[model samples]
Every structure is written in structure tokens, then in C-alpha cells.
Target: MARKPTSPADEVLLAAARARSSTVTATQLERWRGAGLLPRNVTRSLGRGRGSTSAPADGVVDLVVWLAQHARPGRRPHDLALHAFGEGLAVPEPTVRAAWRASVQRVVLSGERDLPAPADGEDRTDWAWDVAERAAANAASVVLPRRMRRIDERLAAAGVSWAPSELTQYDRGPAGEEPVTARDFATFAAAGVLAGAPELTGPAMAPHVRALLPVGAVSPVASWLEYPDEPGRDPAEINDGAGLSLLPIGDVREDLLRVIDEAEPHQLRAAWRAAAEMREWALEHCGAVEAELDAGELGDATLAWMMGAILGLPRLLVRQALLDRRPSISTQVSTAVMVLWIGVSLHRLRRLMPDGQYELLPALLPPFLHPLAGIPLKPVGEAAADDAVG
Candidate 1:
């Protein structure tokens, strides 16, 4: 049976409740109601069958205030909805979960679609836009796992647990930073190969060249190798004339340089495709990890590996950005932002885990710092000889 409509006096009553309980504004009440976080106001017709005035349901004022206190700034609507559901605010769990998942998926899809294509040249405007898009996408990617983890926390706090409709695992181990080491570099080189990246790998610099060349000299060689033909000059001539004794490793360097120069266009396209795939895969894996955590299927080891993978992605992206001489500025900025997000996430994750239980896997450390690929060590007396020559 339909209930009797409330009177205008009920609005005054709600106003009084709001005054006593919380400082929620009239606008907030309407928004909460529209969002289904609160029940709709009841309306009553005047005895003369004239117009009606609406008043909030009993206790809604206090509930709204309570939600306001818990609500954080900058939260997504779905996050707020889920929070309400977790707090037993009368919204259906399935409905809330579905809405939240759909909102997240939409954001992810938009980021993926909006990822800027490679710029034609040094088009600063286009490059800036691309960087902004990339940063936004990367930021989204970083936040996704944190969001999933928060869902688990919220449900656990509320003493609720539910399995998703589908369950599967996609094992792509930790994606981010690696320790500076030869073995780690090899691992990444292998991964690049498997990804069908161009044969950009080559032998490390000979020991004598590594020892004789100052770190500064070695740095430019790596960059130059990436675009040897850009100067329209022979890399060997450039190195030999510069007296770096790079001749011993000249053949290997030239081969790698040739691959980079000849295959640059393909490599750039490949990097974009690879980066996109990695982002998509990482997001999917986050969902899987969350589900596994709920089911008690995920252990510390697996969790650590997953965290490492997430952390590794930023490094990979940044490396690719740097490798492209005419890189999208957006990609560089986004990669940096992603690294920050990943670092924060990792710190939080570490706090939750047992001491020494989580260790980042040794993998693609930064090129400049990698023992094999990095600048060669200098002999103690070599600097004196070079200084004398200078």
C-alpha cells in the first residue's frame, strides 16, 4: 500500500536534524539522494490538491552527515557508492559493485584510446598533448591496483566477502624497476626479444674502452648508438677520432646502431603497442590479484611478484621514452608520474607485508647504472694519464 505523503513541515524537521547532527547543505542532500546513497524525499499534496513540497525521509539527515564525514575529497562517484554499500547504507552490493567496476573500466578504456600517437616531428603542441594524455593514462593505471586493494579493505572492514562472477589468473610477473646488474639487463633484453622488439641488443663495451672512457663520454655513446645515422656520420669515426678507443667494440656497436637507425620507425611503433599491451595486461592482472586475495589464493610471494611487475612498468616506459630521440614529452612526464604513484603504492604495500617478505625482483635497472651496459669503470691511474694528455 502507498504511504501518506509528508508535509512541508517535514522539511523544517529535516533542517532541524541537519543542524543538530551534521553540516550538510541542501545541495548535498539532493546529490546523495540522486546518487542513491540516500532515500528520496517524500512529497505531500495540500488539502486543496495544490502543489507539493518534498521532505527527506526520517534519519536521512543524520545519515547524510555521517557519509559526509567519511567521504574524502576527489573520490570518484563509484568509490563513494561502494563506501555507502560497505557501510550498510541500504544500496545493493551487486549494484554498487557493478557500477564501480563499470566506471573503472570506462576510465581505463578512455585512457587506452586517448593515448597519443607518435608525433610527426618536434611538434611541441602535439607532443605536449600526447604527454598529458600519457601521464593521465599512466596515473590511471597506477591507481587501478590501489583501488582494487581498497575494495578488499572496505569489504573486509564491513565483514563482507563475495566472489566475482569470473575467476582467472594472468601471470606476468612484477613490471617495474630492477637492480643495476648485468644479469638483470640480460633479462630485459630477453623480454624485448620476446616482445618482438628489434634486435637492439649487442655485446657490452670492451673492458679497456670501459676503463679508458670517462663516464660522460660513455653516456653519449649509448644515446648516439640509438640514432647513429641521425648525424649522417660514421659512429666509428666519431668514437675513434674522439680517442675513446671504442674501436675494439666498434663492430658490435655498429651492428646495434644499425639496427636502431634502420628500424627506428618500426621500433617506435612497437614500443607504443608494447606499452599499451602492458598497461592493459597490468590492469587485468590487478583485478585477478584482487579476486585471488579475496579467495586466499594469493600468497606473499605472488603478491610481491605482482607488485614488482607494477613497479617495473614505469621504468620500462621511461626507458622507451628516452630511447626515442624525438620522444613524446607527454610520455616522459606520464612515466615520471607513474613512477611516483608506483613508489607510493609500493610503500603502502610494504607496510602491510611482513618484514623482509617482499623483495623487488632484480631486472631492468636503469641503463646508465646497469653494470654491463653502464659506463665502464676507470682504473686508478688512468685519470692521471688522460689529465696529462689534456
Candidate 2:
């Protein structure tokens, strides 16, 4: 059913929407237009000092119907934008960027927000030091999800191994060369990714990555991750050089927002793919671990995979993602950007290696995740040149 030009545009859209589902209303169209979930009709003036006439663009009625279907009380416009993006709906670019901004702010620490304004003529170094202190304290923000902890306890009882002993012996976290607990190391690593803490780029976090991988055979990605921090070496010669630091002092959120705001549609799609793959990896590993627990024995590989997927890369991605804990589409889309950030970082670290030194393994490498996210991996320089062109 289509509306004739004789009908009012809002009425046409509302009727089309209501035709699909009677719940849609004229007021709903107005509200969604205000929120950017729906676009207003286009208008053109009559030639002879007459008022303009208007009509909704083609297919807006369907979009209106889709928006209404997703609508609910308490849903934010950002949520609608993200959901629209995920579904390939015609949600506006500005709304999607706004959604990305909200997602970035979610993990920002309270200290970053509440810093006292610099006292008149006080050294800016004081503010710098304050930032460094709060950032170092970022590791304290790590929390083993309650459900994951419970699963670990269950597995520990079932003769499945918990966090590897190597984790305790590994040099890890802000405390240099000191052994840290598995959860401690993983927690710090999670924090470090966002904080640009140097400890993460060093040998410290390699063991955690090793423990997290699901591969049953020799994993190649670990070799690069465990690459030594050479003394007095050229900056390009080590992982510390190309590590995940973002400019403007590694405010990843700012860079990530820029990426989203500026990325081409295909790039965004690729990022989404990578995030989905990682999430699947986490789910499959946990499922295997749970199955083993049911059968009364956990595979060593499965245990390691479980820890890596949930604790290693998920970072701020929380909860079991089941029932009430299920993430909203908006949250899911936002978190994908976080994974894209990590994937791009992995790509950067890979560039530190001499050509052919490391193999590309989409199944194992965090860098290849870009391919999963929808980016084709080419030579680093070529990829850079292509991105510049795009």
C-alpha cells in the first residue's frame, strides 16, 4: 500500500508504518524525527506564492516500521542508531557517531572526569602526574566477572586446571619483573590495552595471550607477542615501538571515536565482523569448557582458551550475555569498536616483524581479526596507502 501525493507526508508515513503494525502513530513519527531515528519529509514550494508540499522519501515507511518495532520505553536514541547500523537500516550518520561517543565514555574512569581544575598558575605537570597516577591505577578496575569466577570454581572442583602456573611466575603488570596471579595479570593486561601501559607491550602479557589461545597445536602468534624488549634498540625493532598507544597520550577513546566518525562504511563493516568473530571464539571456548566440566574432565587447551577469550580480549565487555545480561544492540555495536581498536593494534605490532618473519593466522592472530572484521590484510605499507586513499 502506498500513499498518494494528496495525503500529508507524516500521515502517509504513519499510515504505512501502521499498516505494517498498528502500534505506529503520527506522534511516533514526530518523536523519531526529533531523535533522528526517522527523517523528515522533503518539501518543495509551489510556483505562485503558495505554501510548500512535502512527501516522505521512498522506503521511509519501511524504516519507520522498523524503528517502531525496535522502539521501547527508556531506549536511547544512541541505542536506536546503533541498532539501525547493525541492521543496515537508514539511520543517520550523526546519530551513529553520537552512539559511538556514548560507548567511548562508558569505560572512562571517574578520575578522568573529576580532576580538580588546575589551581591558578599551578604547574601543568601536576595535572600530568595526576593523570599518570590515575591511569596506573587503571589495573585496579579489572574485575573477574562473577559468572566467570563461578565457572572457574566449578572447573577447579572438576579437575580442570585454573589459570596457568606460568602466569604466577611471569613478569607482569606495573610491578616490574614480579610474578602476578593469573587474574591479576589478565586484569592488568585488560587495563593496559586502554591505558597504553608499557608493561603490556613488554614480555609480561605474552604468557596471558598464550594461555588464552584455543589452538591445539603450536601457535605462531605467541612468538611475536613474546618478542623480547631489546636494549638500546631502534624504536621500530620491538613490540614497545608499534604497541597500541594512541596519540595525544593514548586516549584510545578519542582515537576510536575519530575512527568511527571518519571510517568508510566498509571499514565499519569489517570492524563489526572482527568483533563478532572474537565473541564467537569466546562463546565456543566457554562452551567446550562447560561441556568438559559436565563430562568430569576439562581439556588443558579448552581451559586456556576459556581464560583467554573471556579475560584477555573481552576487556570491558561484561556479563554472560544471556537472559537479562544480554547486551543491547547499541552496546554490542559500541563494543565492536573496542575490538576493532585491538585488532588494529595487533596489525601495528605485526608490522614490527621483518617481512615473512610471522605467519598470518586469522584463526590465532589478533591482527588477522581485521580480516574477520571485514578488512583484507595486505602488506602493511600497502594497507596504509590504501587506507589513505579511502
Candidate 2 runs further than 4 Å off: 1-8, 42-55, 116-177, 181-248, 270-280, 296-326, 346-359, 365-390
For model 1, state the Cα shift of residue 335 in Å.
25
**Superposition error at 387 for model 1 (Å):** 79
Candidate 2 per-residue C-alpha lDDT over 29-114 given as tens digits, one digit per residue, 9 for 90 to 100: 76887998876688999878888899987667777877878888998888777777777677766777677667777765445566
Expressed as tens digits, the lDDT of each residue in 67-170 for candidate 1 is 66765667655556545543445443344534433432332223225544344433433433343344333232221233434643644454432221221122
What residue runs in model 1 are displaced by over 4 Å at the alpha carbon?
1-20, 34-36, 43-62, 71-73, 91-98, 106-111, 114-390
TM-score of each: 0.25, 0.63
Best by lDDT: 2
How much does candidate 1 score in TM-score? 0.25
Relative to the true structure, candidate 2 reaches a TM of 0.63
Predicted model with the maximum TM-score: 2
